[model samples]
Target: MDLLKKKILAEGSVEEGNILKVDSFLNHQLDVAFLNEVGKEFKRLFEDREITKILTLETSGIAIASIAAQYFNVPVVFAKKIATKNLDKATYESDVYSYTKGRTYKIKVSKKYITSDDRILIIDDFLANAQAALGLMDIINKAGATLEGIGIVIEKGFQDGGELLRKQGINLKSLVIVDSLEVGNIKFR
Candidate 1:
C-alpha cells in the first residue's frame, strides 16, 4: 500500500472541500499495472471470503471492479448511474449523493445479476461520504445476496463513510486512507 500511497501523494491533487482528484490515473485515464496491484491486494485482503460476484457503480467503478474480478474469478456487475430504455422495470434501484459531482442520482442494477446464493464484493475507486457504497449495499440487500466485503482503492479517512460502514458491521477495506489534505499536503492514516 506504500506504493499506492506514494502515487497519491505525487500525482493526486487536493481540491477545496477535501476532495482528492485522482482523475489522471484512476477515474479518468487508468493505469493497468497499478490496477493489477490493487486487484491483488483486494484478493489478498478478502482471501478468506467466498466472493461470487463483484458489484460496483457505473463509470468510475467499472474498470476497477472488472480488473479486480480477474483476480476473484467472478463476474462484475455495475449499477448504472442513468436509467436506460433497455433496462427492466423490475430492477433494484438506489439514490446516491456524489460529493465530487455535486449532485444526487439514482443507480440501478438488474435483478438477474445478483441472487440469494451469491456473495458479493463491492469495489470502487474512492470512498468519502460512502453514499454510493451504501446505495450499492442496499441493492445487494434487495437482491437477497450477502455482502462479502468492500474493497476501496482510496478512502478519505477524514470523512464519515468508512466509519459509518464499519459501525454498521460491514467488512470494508481501503488500500490508501487519507487522514488529512490540508493546504495541498497529503496525510495518510
Candidate 2:
C-alpha cells in the first residue's frame, strides 16, 4: 500500500471539486504491475473469506476487479451503467447518485451471473460517498447473495463513505486512504 500512496502523491491531481484524479496508473490508463500489487493486497486482505465471485461497477472498477478475480479464482461480474441489448430483461438494478458527476443513474446486472448461494466480494477504485457500493449491495440483496466484504483501492477518507459503510458493519479494506485533499495536498489516513 505504500507504493500506491507514493504513486498517488507523485501523480495524483486534485480537480476543482475535491476530486482526486489518479488517471496515470488507476482509472484512465492501466498499470498492470501496480494493479498486480493491488490484487495481491486485496487477496491477502480477503483471503479468509469464502468469496464465490467478485462484483464491481463498470468503467472504473472493471480492471481492478478483473485482476483481483485471478487471485480469488472467481468470475468478475460488473454492473453496467448503460443499458444494452445484450443485457437480460430480468436484471437486478439499483440507483446510484454520483457525487462527482452530480446525477443519479441506474446500474444493472444480469440475474444469471449472481445467485443466492454465492458469497460476493465487492471491489472498486474509490469510495467517496458510498453510493456505488450501496448500489452494488442493493443488487446483491436483490439476488439474495451474501456480501462477504468490500475492497477499495483509494478511499477518500475526508468524505463519509468509508465511515458510513463501517457503521453498517461492512468489512471494508482500503489500500490508501486520503484524509485530506485541500489545496491539492494529499494527506493519508
Candidate 3:
C-alpha cells in the first residue's frame, strides 16, 4: 500500500474536477508487473475471506479485476455498461450514475455467471461517490451471492464512498486514499 501511495504521489496528477489521473500506471496504460503486486496485496488482504469470483464494473475496473483474479485463481465478471447482443437476455441489472459522464447507465451481468452459491470480491480502480460500487453490489444481491469484500486501488477520502460502505458493514480495502487534492499538493490518509 505504501508503494501505491508513492506511485500516486510520483505519477498521479490532480486534474480539473478533483480527478486524480493515474492512467500512467493504474489505468489506461497497463502495468502488469505492478498490478501483479497489487493482486498479491488483494490476496493478502482478503485471504481470510471466501472468494469464489471477482466482480467489477466495465472499462476501468476490468484490468484491475482481471489482474487480481489471477491471485485468487477465480474468474472475473464485469458488468457491461452498454448492452451487447452477446450478453445474455437473462441478466442481473442495476442503474449507476456516472459523475464523469454526467448521466446514468444500466449495467448488466449474465445471471449464469453469478449464483446464490458464489462468494464475490469486487475490485475497481477508484471509489468516489460509490454509485458504481452500489450498482455492482445490487447485481450481487440480485444473484443472492455473498459479497466477500471490495478492493480499491485509490479511494477519494474526501468523498463519502468509504464511509457509506463501512456503515453497511462491507469489507472494503483501499490501497491508497487521497484525503485531499489541493493544487500542487496531494494529501493521503
Give me the candidate number with maximum lDDT.
2
The lDDT for every candidate, in the order shown, is 0.92, 0.95, 0.93
RMSD of each predicted structure: 0.9, 0.7, 0.7
TM-score versus the correct structure, for each prediction: 0.97, 0.98, 0.98
As for lDDT, the candidate ahead, 1 or 2, is 2
What does candidate 1's lDDT look like per residue over 1-189, in tens digits?
A: 998988887788988888888888888999889888888999999999999999999899999999899999999999999988999788999999999889999999888898889999999999999999999999999999999999999999999999999999989999988899976799998
**TM-score of candidate 2 relative to the true fold:** 0.98
Off by over 4 Å in 2: none
TM-score of model 1 vs. true structure: 0.97
lDDT of 3 by residue, 1-189 (tens): 898888888887998899888899988988788899999999999999989999999899999899989888999999999998899999999999988789999999999999999999999999999999999999999999999999999999999999999999999999988899976799998
Query: Model 3: what TM-score?
Result: 0.98
Candidate 2's residue-wise lDDT over 1-189, tens digit each? 899999998888988888999999999999999999899999999999999999999889999999999999999999999999989999999999988789998999999999999899999999999999999999999999999999999999989999999999999999989998976688998
Question: For model 2, what is the alpha-carbon lDDT of residue 180?
Answer: 88
- Mark the 10 consecutive residues where model 3 has the least summed lDDT: 3-12
